[model samples]
Target: MSASAPTSFDKILIANRGEIACRVIRTARDLGYRTVAVFSDADRDALHVQLADEAVCIGEATASQSYLNMTAILDAARRTGANAVHPGYGFMSENAEFARACQAAGIVFIGPPVDAIHLMGSKRLSKIAMQDAGVPCIPGYEGEEQSDEQLLKEAKRIGLPLMIKASAGGGGRGMRVVTDASDIPEQLRSARSEAKNAFGSDELILERAVMRPRHVEIQVFGDTHGNVIHLGERDCSVQRRHQKVVEEAPSPAVDDALRARMGEAAVQAAKACDYVGAGTVEFLLDDKGDFFFLEMNTRLQVEHPVTELITGLDLVAWQIRVARGETLPLTQDQVQLNGHAMEVRLYAEDPAAGFMPQTGPVLAWQPASGEGVRIDHGLRAGYRVGSHYDPMLAKIIAWGDTREDARRRLIRAVEDTHLFGVTDNRRFLAAILRHPVFAEGAATTAFIGADFADDAGMHALAPQSHHWAIAAVLLSSQSPVTTRHWRNSGPHTQRLVLLQGDTRQTVSLAVSATAGPGVLDVTVGDQQHTVRLGASNQCIDNQSIEVDGVIRQPAWHRDGTQLWLDDAGQVFSISDVTHAPPATTAGAGTGQIRAPMDGAVLDVRCAEGDQVSKGQVMVLLEAMKIEHSLTSDVDGIVASVTVRNGDQVKGKQILLSITPDAPEA
Candidate 1:
């Protein structure tokens, strides 16, 4: 175990999935190490599986049955003859028991020491440890008392506008912001339930929510040789639901003095637990320029690419080198920060609809490519996105000499990136990048909620006459025909009802003889336009259409009468209600609760014949690792419950039915 000894492992098993696994594989391969990938049934054909030197099927689609199955992961490593295990980010990455298991199995875990993981894994314990280490921490309650009365008492003592967080939770799960004292009880219940389901722990922690604080985290690394260094800091202030959306290096608010202080505090926090390998110390900086320790993430962060871009270093590579007993390559003074770097997390979720996750096949994916642009993803055409995991599809990073330059480049890159079949947040991220508040570098944690609360990004773009005309022409014909049917016969007109959010547009395509063989006279409301159809390159659900004289290659995915078009960065769902069936009125007349998205029913709150009030929780559905409660729209007696707990449901599927209240019997 000498510090200078050569790394022992020839093959490293990545016990995780998605972009992070692929990320680690690339770096390990560059270091001349063969990589093994463990995959769940859902990820059988994932890009990471194909890129690895060896692949193993661990278990089922659910994370607990697969990626989180420590025993199965270790067995896969043993079967593949892998001498080391790299827990890439999410699954079991910071689990202390997983690290200990790796050590007992005689495999190198490419992360921090087991003690460090244990200490930072619990929010309550980590806050106490940070205070003891002389790190400034937020005022809150971190006691052993678990009673509801005790928690209520502490919340009152801490004052209102506090945060209730799960001791063992990350990624914004098991966390709630309580503004009013009356809402604390309900928030506490929800947080505990989500925590137990997500992390197998129900421990709670309370902290005073800092108003409009900037989230800044210092990336620190350590080695077995007792060397540690901080690689500057990243500002992750642009967040939604307490999770980071956009991250950038060299925070706009931090100067040399503040950075030095934060970096020193981060390094001290790491040393307090004898931490080793890559870890991040998060802090919330207030308006007064004071920073408080939040927590520590003992794994490669999702926003690590921004740090790498600014520092000219591969953090994953450093992790492996450190795990192999290598000392720090550069001292704190030697490490230099370069140009500004920014990253946006591209997710398959609809920002217009409460950021609900969407799942489907990736019909077409064209990532942006140019100078200063980098796409880190595990996505490919034909890849199926399931609701069994996170909704993030990729991370796009851009670097420039200035923050504005980096921001502009990232915006342009996001505009060029196109995806189909699944609804995504590409336009949403672009909007955030171009917002004046963000452009001025003054975005805090309240950026999303305050500035773009209504999701103006998706609705800001009004469909032009040309856009409607293009849609009409594409929908009028399925193939190229030699004879002009409308010319030979009478003028035939087709009507299309296109829906975008709540707005609906009726487009009529009138095929006439005077117009060419493939020409159509389109009319949308009072706007009239002439559109000519040209050669189309159709690939499954995707198509490149030439409308009028302009050629736009829009990624298209059609399901029955509904078509999704990804043109540039804008996404539109066009429904051709030409041959649609009559709607059923029975469920509409009565009260019916339908599933919001494709997910598994986690709990059923009511049974048949049960009386329920309006806005009462009827069914709880779990999708994309988040729980959504389906509430009753009208107070009525339950007539039938179609779905039970553990039942998988599709979007708009009826989960239960309620009969209108009866008059006096």
Candidate 2:
């Protein structure tokens, strides 16, 4: 690779979607290149589509036909007369064959060489590269070990809390944490199964696990001509299930000396593979400050915004620049970082419900703003959140003069946010941002685990806040203060929403005819939560609405007197008691709840009702969405059976019920 600008390629094809696609297009446009966007059928009206100079529908709902389809992406590039192709992140971003295809078609692939991609793509192969580069690595069996006996010998060397990682894996998939030696065999089997299903490879790698370590990575850039520079480090220790939830720059943990060591290690690793363009060298830093090489990502990362904010560099633009034969404009000595930056991933999952992926239309949405807040979003309000790709909805990034300022600002940003529709985990993110431990920056990869012991901890705030918010909103159900219930000045009635866990109050409360619309004021105790409504809140062209300060589209439904609010894949039912039945016979129906969705049978309690206590776990269901336990609504006897073992039931379907007794039954 050389450091001279080649000066070619008039048009480039972006073979991805979501924020990454838009991210690449922004850089391409700045580089005087016409951009073409390849979108799936589900992304026809996506934000990226609107941003691209040209857009072509690549395939159906699933990624198999669109982003992952090599032929389709290459064909799009060829059809669009694009001389270069950018894979962005995920999908085929690191696929060696995909890169080679672009080269074969005479189009520049905006990544490392095919050989480097292939070598680093395999964890086993990368181990060899890292070893050759003198990078510190945990003792593991990257070599062939067929029998349990052979693997066990290596496991003892790696010690307990070992990891069973897939040779062909990234983004935390195809990996398992094995804590006990006795669990190794079964885990090996399951890990291999997951790897096969996910990456079409059962080739597994084993490595020692670091105890309570910070997940830090150095962002490095390289060129064809023996040149490379490190862009400091990013702290991604705050995570859940080995995936980063929040990320920041200039780690509160890593000082200058440690950052230098990591930066040098990262530079050497990149040079070992002769890497080019934007990439990351991940590391697992132990409690004792000792570090071990985790893996090298040969493409842009989702949390690149943090680095960009601190270094005042557009990583995507630099990637394009270096790919186009430009030297890294800044030298190693010139590379300096200022200020602190934090980024929170907004996912479409319910944190309380085990972070399961949710899908629906964005009924209302508005990204947080003011000061240093920026939102890298994929969908607009009203756009449907599909189940085809990742569940991440957006990246809400904020920069501040210091880490504490960033933390405080991010919390304020979230609190002011108001959203509904397509369920987003904004509130959960807000909770994490404001968490005492997180605020102190004493985080590790297992941070979420260290704190969120239960559903209440997951939210990190008083349950009454929601109650107050709902109460304020519900107040809208009553007429305005100026008009009495008997008077006709104010609107008589309004809409009261009931979800599985939360409630909302909406109304057409008017002060003047020209007032247009107002807000839903939710009151709890001494606090009042106001959510904007009507014209000022709507997106105009889309179904999404913006109330307070968050971006969300809540899932909603109505049945009889109960209105449900589905936010981020969680069904929170709030009672709409305006019309509930007055009274029932002694033993009729206590309305025993059942499984609301399909999931694995984890635990089961209670047989028939047998006069069980309220909120008692009746059964447990573990789905890809998350884990939830069904509880009894009231005391009664098991009345009917509609489902059994492994049966998948739709929401609201009666699985088993406890028919109330007539006092003597």
Candidate 3:
């Protein structure tokens, strides 16, 4: 490969999955490079696999056996004659060893140098490097001594409300906030466990937690020729569980002076590690406008689309060029920030349920499309959402002339988007976009937990009287007798149960068969409506339902006795319980502990006869690369343990049984 060949890749193997993979493939394809997608068993039929020129199955559903398996990925690259490898964001994106392996295997790693990744991979080491480079860093201890006692002492010295973070962790894993001194030991244990599981390291660093700070990150780019530039900053303060839910470019709080200072600091941080390609230098912007270095992400971010939109530049394309030993495309002075851009991560989790990861078929997937709206997703209708990956389903980004314009466009775009069948955070994201705090650009790290922590964001869609009538007509249309005998009966009443969130409503429908096959006169409550089904405008398997003269293309799907509808923006799940079997008491409030979702049991904290207290963690379930502690609901003695560590269990499957303690005499 010549040094002048800036974009000289015949084929590139994407060593990741989901939307990021698809994003990279789109850029690679546009650059006239053949893309090879690697997938696990669960993602064999995923959008990324289908979009690539060729695809190879790396391993099983587990990330360790697939995306993160360095040996398997190298082998796949070799087998497919892939000349370059693109680790898109997650998995092995920042793994220095993986980059070294790629170099040893003679494949181009489209990222930073191995030395850079190694130095910045550890938060402690990176902080030291930044301090030495004269960058503003958070006041903390990043010593090599990492014993439990030392950590506790450091936590004390750092004062209350300190943070314990894994030295080699990112993406909010291996991180914990300790507001009380007594909780340090337990938080340390949990943080270390997660760190070891996530980054293969248990070493920790202590820092004083900056309260109510805004998370602002600068997008930096570098090349092998010693050129680096910052593309302004993005405010990612709208977060949940320490992970960013919404991100926007040209932070509302950052003025021109602040932007220059933060951008210069970010560029210095990048230069300290001799960084290359796309990287983000995150900072905690305090109330007084003082910013401290948080960490550096040495890979493309999931929210890269916002930067791309605002700058009108393709970051993936830049990564490819930089990997080929190219010079920087533009200098710092040449980099210009354009209009305001914002993005929201649409996740496959129920925000009302503590953001628990959900797995089910995507019955209907209709992404928003318009002039300013950009939807980056890797989902399709009928796509099965497994528990072995992140819960993020898609990202909706909108760009406009101003921040308010962008915010309004994004809210409308989110409302226009729809994803059915699985419990998702669409409504939750819409609520966030419309929240007063968010709209005012005053969202801090505690925005979600403080403002919309409960189901306030999940307000139920008020069911109109005509909606019930439409439901009745649709229900009756499903019956064979109603279609055959159009003008027979005067009116027939039917009862159906529909569940939305925690509220269950029994809807009574009186339909007249004389109205004809395509139309029905239905009475729901005291109101009556003439509902009609329009001519099937089949876009894939979805159809349009014309009710009372209004034509609505409702994205809908049916599976057995369940029907899901996405009318306008509200997603309604209707189930027919007319002839359903009586509810069984087999698992009714039994002290049996069930798995929260499909996951592999990482460890069982209690034995069969072990006595446990209420809220004591009995088992640790690992799913989507995150560990979930299954706690006991009541104080009891473990009666039976049915699952062992490493056992793969389905959602709601019994893992253990706890017999409640007998009343003390």
Candidate 4:
């Protein structure tokens, strides 16, 4: 056992931004240590910056120039007289070189040893090490020879339905599941490309995809005194696009005996690397009670709140203590897992649009709060959510005496959370929590794709008549009371054409003054409804209204001809185009291929005059840390390409144009 003398640091610097930085600052302040925060230009007014004792602007908005800028971060700590730095997950959190640099600069690094991070950071090397340590691992190829031909040959030998994973980094980036042999080549290329962009490494490892296995991970902690212990397991099988959406502690599938086995294996994995501070060892637990090592995250995880709630422990505090050369507060047997806890990640994204990330001002922010509900976020009214960072905005956690109790509380918490002015997945999260499979704790990694893939709520729904009615009332109310009187006509009729996506709804509205002040008698189709409006609160962009005797207080915002409304968790966007002119086009058959979201152009596959088939990918864009492929909608010849590789673009910006082929020649 290696021992070290206890050290002290008066102030600590956080080398990241957003909720995680705020999380660390809270604990550090509670421990009576002064805290400093660093931010990019985009996050100058971020919640974390406001909460810190002092903040320093690191660099520009892009991550490469800011959060991931190791030299700038270290210099900030030096300039601030911070004796220690806490890298709160992501953006060099697990980087071995950063840890070494911190140590060399005489700044205490509050994480595992540099050697441990260097060894386990690579999936290929970690698997080999785990195998040598007698830890169970899935059978796959982790060879040094990373040729396309070699990978193809190995794929056939490994059989169908295998996974290709980037050797470095996590977060579901650079991962592909190949169920058919024909997809191996393209999937390989995509995975390698993403891996290179995300982790600076294109090397990969292959694993036989475990069928319907639960993604269970054991949370482990270590100290410089050679003590290591586990905090039990969290079931993270519920996922979308290989990214974890929901996480819970004390996995329903892990009984006492199974927990003992998995826990011991996780401890051994940590001890093998001489780990210290906090880490998690993930595994794929099959129905037969067999578990295989997946990977080890060498820093605090995004879902650490679940473990903290159940154990009644402050993990960040433990990290600080261990960094000061203090032994772990509790041993393996002394650590008690008390209650069940569940957590859901809230993202600023549109589930109806293939989970594309959204960015805009936060018109309103009301997070849920209760005895057992906790929210960790960095959001505020009027805060601008940019496209430069990850879309995840907050985490909601709930704890109860039992799993069902925790699940119920979490569901309610999700429903109660309110956010406006941007598209998000709150509705989708509530649906997942209410799912029968998830409620019964039978969810696997295939849960999202199998059950909710085609859920109607996951797609754009046509606007209902009531939606247009509400929009008409709001639009009419924008004018003076005198003009809203309809010129004292016996019956004033108005027409509205509201556009949502590519679908439009035309409604004929006839208003009568007899409905009284703040009310109107609006006719839609053959039905007449009484609509009453309350005073608008522009501060939060919300108002109370009664439609057909049903009272609802929905938050709404208006920008020119567009209106955004949020009722409960559902959002409706209505654009008044009643007097708008016909659409114009430069090519044939919806020929303009536009970017799906704000992103950097990774590749442009077609040039001018190139023949392309329907559904053939013409542009590759990277946004919110995910790659999106923009495809041609009709068979045509490309007329022009407006964007070049490495060009940053906004949402709906045209990338190219195609001229459709003549029919029936």
Alpha-carbon TM-score of each model against the true structure: 0.91, 0.78, 0.91, 0.91
Clashes of each: 0, 46, 0, 0
lDDT, candidate 1, at 386: 87
How do the residues 397-463 of candidate 2 rate in per-residue lDDT, one tens digit apiece? 8899999888888776664444455446777777677677788888788777877444353652222
In order, the Cα lDDT scores of the candidates are 0.86, 0.72, 0.83, 0.87
Candidate 3 C-alpha lDDT tens digits along 521-540: 65555666666675432232
lDDT of 3: 0.83
Better of 2 and 3 by lDDT: 3
lDDT of candidate model 2 versus the reference? 0.72
What TM-score, to 2 decimals, does candidate 1 have? 0.91
Off by over 4 Å in 4: 143-161, 179-197, 481-497, 506-516, 541-544, 559-561, 578-588, 608-616, 634-640, 659-665
**Span of ten consecutive residues with least summed lDDT in model 2:** 534-543
Off by over 4 Å in 2: 1-7, 454-665
Better of 3 and 4 by lDDT: 4
| Tens digit per residue, CA lDDT, model 4, 1-665 | 67889988979999988889999999999999999999999898899999999999999888999999999999999999999999998888999999999999999999999999999899999999999999999999998999999999998899878999999878788998889988999999999998998788999999899988999999999999999999999999998877899999999999999999999999999999999999999999999999999999999999999999999999999999999999999989998998899999999998887788998888778888897999999888778888889999999999999999999999888877888778888888888988888899899998998976776657765656676678777765663432245544566666777787777766655554666545677666666778877776344454778899898776677766777776666677778887789877643357799877788898999899999999999999988877789889889899989999999998888999998888875
Provide the lDDT at 506 for model 4.
Answer: 65
Poorest 10 consecutive residues by lDDT, candidate 1: 479-488
